[model samples]
Target: MKMKVESVNLTDPSLLLRPEPVYDGKPVSAFRNFDDDENDPMKARVRKTYYDMHTNMSVDFVKAKMAKWLKFNHFKATMKEALIKLNDLVDESDPDIDLPNIVHAFQTAERIRDEHPDEDWFQLIGLIHDVGKVMAFYGEPQWCVVGDTFALGCKWGPSIVYGDDSFRDNPDTHNPKYNTKYGMYEPNCGLENLLMSWGHDEYLYRVLVHNKAKFPKKALHMIRYHSFYPWHAGGDYQHLLKEGDEEIKQAVLEFNKYDLYTKSAGIPDVEALWPYYESLIEKYIPGVLEW
Candidate 1:
């Protein structure tokens, strides 16, 4: 919640447990590989999800979604209630972890807790990072509610899952105002100035701020840009980034390891873990939130 800020010891040995991380037998580099393979059903499903997202997620579409969902009028539920809804969701965009999204949630949270036991806010951030996917239950498609996000108005980044071929059907690709290198933005505009495609990252970030959640600024940045792989993970958008944005990128990268690699980790006892996490939720984001 609103705890006093303490300097984190980045060199803590627990954080280095996985120097070359491997999950369930697959190496870390093997994860997030969006290669198209018709013979592999999981690969096909992942491909189709990104294709649908890149095809339909235009500047207008993102704006319309913001106008529709940002009102926080779709429904109201407590943080625990909202997270429980994820029990029924399976992200089609994910190449790993076919289990219910709730399993991944617990896995991420437990992993964060194990490594950063002192940082309750960081652990809570892991628990609820993907809770915005609850938008799926409220009539949004997985393409709009899940998956990696990119800047909507500029030229698509080279590192986005399927690259240019996937966005061929998107109308924004043909518009001069939105297809240029710096489309609708100035140089060194910084990550905050860019309009990202609609997804759970931005949605949940807004929800936390709108509801007055007291997590530190770094926690909010972790939630907001964790899905922005192209910029943080792929080295794109350097021209648009202002000075000090490197800290944001590093924060997202720090959070990303637990989010991405923990999908294949063993599932935690959600029932047993709830008492601890619920306390943190109560401290930070208690009560029914407008969604």
Candidate 2:
């Protein structure tokens, strides 16, 4: 049976506490499955997105993208204005949800609010975490703007969705400086020191800093590494971690639960929720932001 959105009890404390929450009638383990099935359109779409991402996401490519986007010269808009624009985007790399990205944004924020009622900054983080995806409107493709992020100039994590098979076509796979386990990084250099692949995660984190958003450091950390599945979720890159990095991993894990499992949650009344979230936006990330 299809799980109706209304069936989820967002207020149930137990629901918030469960380690393996159910979504759309599937067990949590069933989520994030990257198995190939050419006959399945959703699966095929996801595979193609990752294949393209792996094929082209080289060190030089990521550097060039950073040069293009990090200038913050793109159009300026308030956080709310940027979020509303997501109503037109459907992430091609997501196999789970087909709804406009805006719906997922509210679903994530609302769930975080329910669980961490006092942490307004965390709730705001949830609301705006994907706002960097507004890059899609400026001609960036979904493959680079959405989906999971991994570190560049290092061996690809075995836990990355499609594993080595998907990255076979990438030129970096053959490059001596990038394909090794440690690659260009020294031992214990820490997560922040690594050059992560260019994506919304890095883009929005920089934007928040550049605009002087007042969110706490932990909130900024959550937003920055939430999509770094290989490091946070897959136990990769341990040799590169420094002291206190475990706390960062735990923080990302706490935020990631809502991000991944809330996709099938009930469609929020965004119109009704905006006033509350707007207060949050005003508090932490007010004003027209340079994209």
Candidate 3:
């Protein structure tokens, strides 16, 4: 189901989902390789839109949104329990493989760790890469947890698994001003100038940043771009990029090759790696992550 039409239909209204582009056009079942589907062609013309950096938001307004969400009881569970629960999301949207969510995340992270054994921080990134999926276990819909990252800029990626096109059925896409190619931004702005949909990549990145952790810039790039398949892999939207963004794009593409093409069932046991990581965390994070 990696075909464009199918990938374009990830959030079928019939399934209560909207159209999005979270794949190379593959489908998943109890048994199927998530990787290659012989006939799927994901390399068509580029899709419009990308994540934005600056929001049209004011400090108080941003604070108000955070305050509203902060009022909710997001979670109250141990990391292990949360990890177990996180797998329950079982992305019906992701068709390539049927591995449980944690298993899928482990597959991505573990491969990253094995090939670059010297990069311990990437090992942690591999292990906890999808920690944002915690939101799935916390009662957010798949649309909320697993979509594209974007800024306050207009017309973000529609292929994000957890979001629906109905999200685009609003005035934003049609409004004459926001409908322009750049929306709320000037041309060639860097990602640092954008704001994305609130999700796990940023969540984990914030944890590392605020605590002054030692995650590599590459690891940080992983957190940010694992979901940004279009620009990195598809070569879309380069017209809006700045001078050096291409180099950043190249590095992200190098990292993405590892992320997409590598997966194995023969890796070392994740359970075996946990004890060492637990110590690493004790030294790195606050008492524990919130959810």
Candidate 4:
């Protein structure tokens, strides 16, 4: 059956009496911690996926990926239609919740909306944050499309999750050009010049820019680096920051709260929330867009 998108009325008195969405007060560490051996086999799957991502996502790999994906010829899709495609993506690299990816999208967006009600574009950014994972449905491996992203051309910092041992076998680890502290990039060159590990975050960021979506640069940063746990979460890669990197870093940090801490087993009424998001998508990214 086709998924139903229901419109909800927020001003209804009876609905107001219902409890707001529960947040459970979980710390970010409790969210994506994949080291728990006692956890389900899914954790093992997540571990292996990150291993592959860390090993193969070198600078050249990123450049090749950008060349292939940035062409924007994959397909044309409306924003909502592209987002709905995430229903089929179960990220093997995330140790967090295992529900349909779209549910996580709605959950993240709703949490942002709860606090920043007036920032509709920010809320819309939250909703479609992972929409580029649609590449998974198009036959890309989960390793390339999901998982935490990191700077590819530069040194893989020790702060990267599993960075110490996981990337040892990667060819770039020993390459003279790519193994240094500042591989292939200048000091304080800014993040825009860096080639990040190829993933949904970079893909979606490029998509928004390519389609000329009217989101703020801050929202674009949130989309681009939401998975760069090393920089935003682990405090690595500071040597490469340019003049205003601090402000963009702060924006990513703020968005991270809603993205990570708000994940819950509970699902959102996607249908009830669709109308509001549909309006936002129309305002920012209307009609079919190049992928």
Candidate 5:
């Protein structure tokens, strides 16, 4: 599955350190509802999805999933091909947009492009961020691939969506070693060392690292933890932070503004936009990649 990738010029340090954009129109805060709204018809499905995830995503499950996917033996396709395949995946776990996931891919990328035109790598990361949800297309269920990820081996923070009511049946909730606040990990153990619930975020992060993609640390952190609503959004899990997470946390929050707000019912013209994104992909992660 290996193919040679030409070296893409890295981002200029000046562009990487640009100040955050001033968002126009409505604030992104309007869309941050993680709890079930009694009037919203999608509540039942969303609740059930979280219930399944919280009930089954234990330390053992995370370990087994890491072993399975970290092998990277699933299949091979270029970044464009993988992004197209996402059109077939409708994330039942997402309460936002019910349209094909490809629309959100372009929406997120386009939003970034509009605001941070100088950060081409950042825009590309937006398009491919959810490409890891392709795991569902390969036989993994929606719950396993699309839900918000949390640290599996630690205490489930109150910030997790439905964290209080859903994990009652989970075995880890009763395990003496894992039931406590610190669980199996020590305080201030950086997120890189903890096992997160298996999902698209972790999958795509690993894929980029294994293939030696040219993304920097900020891009890597955003890819791995975009769905970590509990930490980035809820302001929980500060107790688990290591020394330098302050900067990474800021980047994740900035990225979240685009990821959450850009989702819409409008679909992008995939064929027309293909050329520009293809060039960007070639520049960064060229050739067929391991699935």
Candidate 6:
């Protein structure tokens, strides 16, 4: 049977009530924390979804997984077309960051270049890292892509995207293996041994991996596991990693600074910056990129 996805408002109780962010190991709703000056008060009135971090994701783990499947460039269409499609991607639950979709994608990529002018490849990664997020805009649901990426073996962690209260309605949670922590998986299986949620993060990575030489081993690693905050930040999946996963973990940790810290603040003109990015595409990815 095809997987059944429930159409939910972006503000569905599940998303609003999530324990942490779906991609980074942080809060899903900064509702209460917004007023507190202690946790990043530089900006005012942060959108609640901005707090939606990936408690399950880590920058390092994302790097390792993305290196396995990296993309070379942004959407094949012109930036104008890409922006139209991105704008259509409104989250019913995540009403806070209501900017256009391309804006979000651009902010992430542009932030990288601003901080690390020396790392051209990483800047490239920022451009398209979340492009696959458009799948939801195309018709898929949040459950299919935006959530804690877990193994489908025997036991699943209790803190999945929805957690206990939210997953009460999910059929997958009932399956014996799906409910267990290591469901259908053995110890130290490593993320390579798993399949993640089908989203733009994975899709974009696959595109780059096939394109060849889009990003270095380290940057690719950041692309894949940057959303996997659970492993690196919480060390939840340490049980699934092997001895070989150590070094890459360290590299991903460093990359996280840029991904989260680099906001859409004080940036140059995106339209003007395209020429530089376009040149980088010619140098690294092909002039013709796969959608």
**TM-score between candidate 3 and the true structure:** 0.66
Estimate the TM-score for candidate 1: 0.92
Ranking by TM-score: 1, 2, 4, 5, 3, 6
Which pairs of residues collide in candidate 1?
none
Candidate 3: lDDT over CA atoms? 0.50
**lDDT digits (tens) for residues 1-291 of candidate 1:** 112111111122213444566566777656666656667898878777888999999999999999998899999999999999999999999987798898999899888999999999999999999999999998988999999899989898877777787889999999999999999999998889999999999999999999999999999999999988777766789989999999987788788878887878577889999999999999999999998
**Whole-model lDDT values for every prediction:** 0.86, 0.84, 0.50, 0.81, 0.80, 0.51
Residue 79 local lDDT, model 1: 97
Cα displacement (angstroms), candidate 2, residue 2, comes to 26
Candidate 2 lDDT over 136-170, as tens digits, reads 99999888998889999989877777778778989
How do the residues 1-291 of candidate 5 rate in per-residue lDDT, one tens digit apiece? 211211112221222333233233433333434455657767667777878988888888888998999999999999999998988878888877778899899999998999999999999999999999999888888888997888776677766777566889888888888877777888999878777889999999999999889888899999998888777656667878899887887788778777877766567787888899999999989999997
| TM value for model 2 | 0.92
Q: Name the top lDDT candidate.
A: 1
**Of the candidates shown, which would achieve the greatest TM-score relative to the real structure?**
1
lDDT of 3 by residue, 1-291 (tens): 332332333322211121233233432121122233455432111111111211222223334434534443455543445556656655433443345667765676666667888766666666666666676555554544553444434554444322333335444555655556677778878765555555566655654564466666766777776666435533445546788776666556555544444333444466876676666455544254443
lDDT of 4 by residue, 1-291 (tens): 111111111121212232244347543335556563634688678778978887888878888888999999999999999998888778888777788889999998998899999999989988999898999877788999998888876678666766557888888988989888889889988877777899999999999999999988899999998888777666677888888888887788778777776678778999999999999999999999999
Off by over 4 Å in 2: 1-17, 21-24
TM-score of each: 0.92, 0.92, 0.66, 0.90, 0.88, 0.66
Which wins on TM-score, candidate 3 or candidate 6?
A: 3
> What is the alpha-carbon lDDT for the whole of candidate 4?
0.81
Least accurate 10 contiguous residues by lDDT in model 1? 1-10
In terms of lDDT, which candidate is stronger, 2 or 5? 2
